[model samples]
Target: MAESDAWILTTGLNNGVSKLVGEGISQYRLLRRHPKDVVCIGLTMWGTINEKTRIDLKKASQIGASDEACKRQIRDDVQEDKETLDPHHTHCILFDSGNLNEYLSDSQRSSFVQYVCDDKNSHACKEVFFDNMNFQQRLIEL
Candidate 1:
């Protein structure tokens, strides 16, 4: 299947909004791998609401704030950016993860995690994971 066709497959995932973000980065890189894809997938797992949830997204170069701040920033930025950019041109996908069940299934999240781990998309995940490892390790310490 073509890139566009594969994008359609992600459209049905629980992480659809995030997959779109990652795919946009993939397209931006002209089919080359990008660090954003894995970050986007990881962000999707953090849940969309609750300001604390978005802290993980701060690792993405495209996002400028911690997870909590990112939730509010993304909403405002997307709305403002949308005024000047076409919907399709807006590279970031900003839906609430609190509503993830409305969009993706448990299996879909597993698929996303796998995709991020897959060698083909490991760059994104590695970047995201490194940034979050300190935090994750602290959690383990607890």
Candidate 2:
């Protein structure tokens, strides 16, 4: 349990562990009344997501891009190195390292969790990353 709001972070891929995370979120959402009660964030590397898919994501955020246009972009695509994002996630954060192949470094996720746990610095939001975690900012994540 957490003294403050909780967050769920994942790679956002529709396969493997990330896929399971998405399913869990779906079940949680079913019982919760408010949609914003929980935050499940999908963090992924920009290089992994396809170019057109990237565009669709951008447009999807703004004007609500048509489902058909988004479909056309991936019509000819064969599933290979690229990953399909889990639809259950509430938000997707694509990190661009400017490299063709890049993933979340341990330090990247670590630092972010640290910042969130450190309530003193996170004046913008008072969120407790985990139970055993305090202002000391130990490796507390979920």
Write model 1 residue lDDT over 73-105, tens digit each, in one string.
344334321111112322333345554324334
What is each predicted model's overall lDDT from 0 to 1? 0.34, 0.64
Q: Write the per-residue lDDT of candidate 2 for residues 1-142, one digit (tens) a residue.
A: 1234556677777878778877877877786676445676777787777656677776767665666534534446555467767898777778788775576675666666666666563444433232122433324433
Off by over 4 Å in 2: 1-4, 31-36, 61-80, 118-142
Say which candidate scores most in TM-score.
2
Instruction: Please give the distance, in angstroms, between residue 68's alpha carbon in candidate 2 and its true position after superposition.
Output: 20
True-vs-predicted CA distance for residue 115, candidate 1, Å: 27
Candidate 1 TM-score, true structure as reference = 0.21
Clash count, one per candidate:
5, 0
